[model samples]
Target: MRTASWGRQAGGYAAVVTVAETAGLTWEKDDRPLRGVPGAVRRDHGDLVKELRDLVKRVGVQLGTLTRALEGGFTVDTVHPYGWWRAELAGHPLARAVVRRLIWEIEVTPGQWRPVLPEAEHLPDAPDDALVRLWHPIRSDPGTVRAWRDLLTERRIQQAFREIYLLTPAEEDTRVHSNRFGHLVHHRRMFALFRARGWASGLLGPWDGSDEDEAVRTLAAGAWQVRFFHARADWAGDHELATTGQVRFARRLEGTWREVPLAEVPPLVFSEAMRDVDLFVGVTSIAADPDWTDRGPERAYWELAGFAELTESAEARREALQRILPRLEIANRCSLDGRFVVVRGDLATYKIHIGSADILMEPDNAYLCIVPSRRKSDGQVFLPFEDDRLSLILSKAFLLASDTKITDESILTRIKRGA
Candidate 1:
């Protein structure tokens, strides 16, 4: 099975919140910081592709600058923030191309579809379309994509194009809500992946709304859909924002910004429950639960409830801190245990080893990983834990013996070598 990841949720949230907060701060200083940037870019498939093209071009400009730096051996390392050049280049043009090619293989290519057989070993040779999709981005050029234009349907074309567009920001398998057309329309956010054409691949969100429910009905049938949290019955508004990750909201109070913990939010405001769950579950619960819109004093009541959840005040906050301590401690690390690899990037990383499974025709499909993270900590690197690792699942990592240059193999090798 393809991997699922949530690493982008929190980082995306942080980016937005930081922008909001920074905008607010600049407003206080009488200077506009986000004036030129769109409030937040959102789009459907077509518009998303356009936005992606624009983003890629911009990124290309940056990559050009980094290309200059690399010639001088300016490797991006944790010890030096200056090496952001590499990080900036991580999920760029080439990466985006890989994503699109994979999506075409998983979603559009015909006859290449392989069931998630319980005991199949190694994947069959993908259809010609799948291979073309894989190489398209790497070899993308007017002539290259044009010669194969007839090979992809308009939808697949757009999808693959968007996949390439998405690659730049999809480091560690953190796909974005904006990248997926209708994701933010349903849950606050979501991530998706696909491997072929004429096949179905995408993720389900945590919320259930009319529009989202409708899309899911259309997409879920005869395809793969994994709903992380069941939508609550009462939620009235789409809490797509909740899926952004370890979300915390703050409102200006008496000229000061106060952190509003999720748990402290009025339970009645949530159409569902939010206490005692992992990152995705708790946040998605709040977003899908339908108690936020009742007619009442929004601020006063919320503040009172927030204080109430703090009955033990400091102790309760401390416990809440303890609950998130592991996540916080390893927020940007990746770990490995036996056959599984768990990643904890800005989003979540959860992977399982299929080595023992009989679904592969070769050893290449032995491992399936979600989002992965690479961090330099005291000169030692970490992989996922055997169990007890809780993060969003993103990306799939397959192993190949040395000498393979396929994207998956290259990525794994780079990760291993870096670690």
Candidate 2:
């Protein structure tokens, strides 16, 4: 009396369906003359019923194997067997139909494992609301979700690249290749560069021939690339001067430099060259904002003050500060020197002499400091405020402070009362 919903096969295509139990088994085919005849009454019904029972048994075994695979911990290697089984099952009309009716979802965890139920909602550390909203549809039709997950994975990889390296809108648009192998190669190179820079967390690759679905699942589970890009003058020594003599092009891989034909370079290699060129230009340029160079020390000092102001009690503020201060870059760490704050940079340790209207630096005794500019131009003007490294440190400190405690207005109550 147990009913199992199986997929409906019409014109060789299996469509999803629901099932209900009945006292007698009946076989109904759209093209066949037989219509809902009870198995007990018809002689041919015996063979039909036996065939259906066998089909159901086979499907049940496949489903069980898939479930156990998920439970034991699914990985790229582990899923291969399941994937093969799924393919075999899908090739059989009855098995394919049965699988279409099965429900599966990814259990959101530090490990991306498939589960029989939507268990992400029950996990305390999981983003249940967001996962439910985004992953519900994917779970409903697990058999076909690989393509969707692959797209998601590709987007995440591209985002990781963008976070560390600046890309033009046009360059970003052009990065995706129609060729899957070419695209994979591009991601492989990107991951290698990311790892080399010490920006990778967790296992980044076996990218040369990895299954796309496994790659997607792995990235979704907290693996990340670093958020900074570098192009060294020494790294540029590999390329020949351009015919125009206006630019240089090179390729540096595994600490070895080589000249590559610019015109014949692969799309992936060309994209990498673009990143190096952009970084080189960005670092060597100056800024249009005359005041941009002198703004770093002021901004860094204010960021510290704003971070400290989040907690009301002096002791609480000190506790919150302990959590925030370590996020600062070693070079940008400021020390109170009587009335001034000292910031050590690569070239010099700047003693920032603060004033009501203008700030100044000593050793160089310069009114302004040179920093990198964010301006998009063939040529750049460097200024102190434009150095993304300093900005990132300050931003991290602010975020740490904001996340540590609630910023109550009670901290300013005493000052208002005095006024």
> Which candidate number maximizes TM-score?
1
Clash count in backbone of candidate 1: 56
Q: Write the per-residue lDDT of candidate 1 for residues 1-419, one digit (tens) a residue.
A: 12111111211221111110011111111222343223343322345435444654664555445433332121111111212312332223333222222222122344342221111123334332332212223224455543343333321221212111212233224321111111111233322211111112244444344222211111111122122222222333343332222212233457554544333332221111111112233223222222343433332332223212111112222222233324434433434433333333221233332121111112233222223342233312122211112222211222221113335664455444433
**Residue 17, candidate 1: alpha-carbon lDDT:** 15
Scored by Cα lDDT, where does model 1 land?
A: 0.26
What local lDDT does model 1 show for residue 60?
53
When summed lDDT is taken over every stretch of 10 residues in candidate 2, the lowest stretch is 177-186
Candidate 2, 121-204: lDDT as tens digits:
222233323121112221234444434333323222110111112233543444431111111012333334434422332322
Off by over 4 Å in 1: 1-57, 60-213, 217-232, 235-283, 286-419
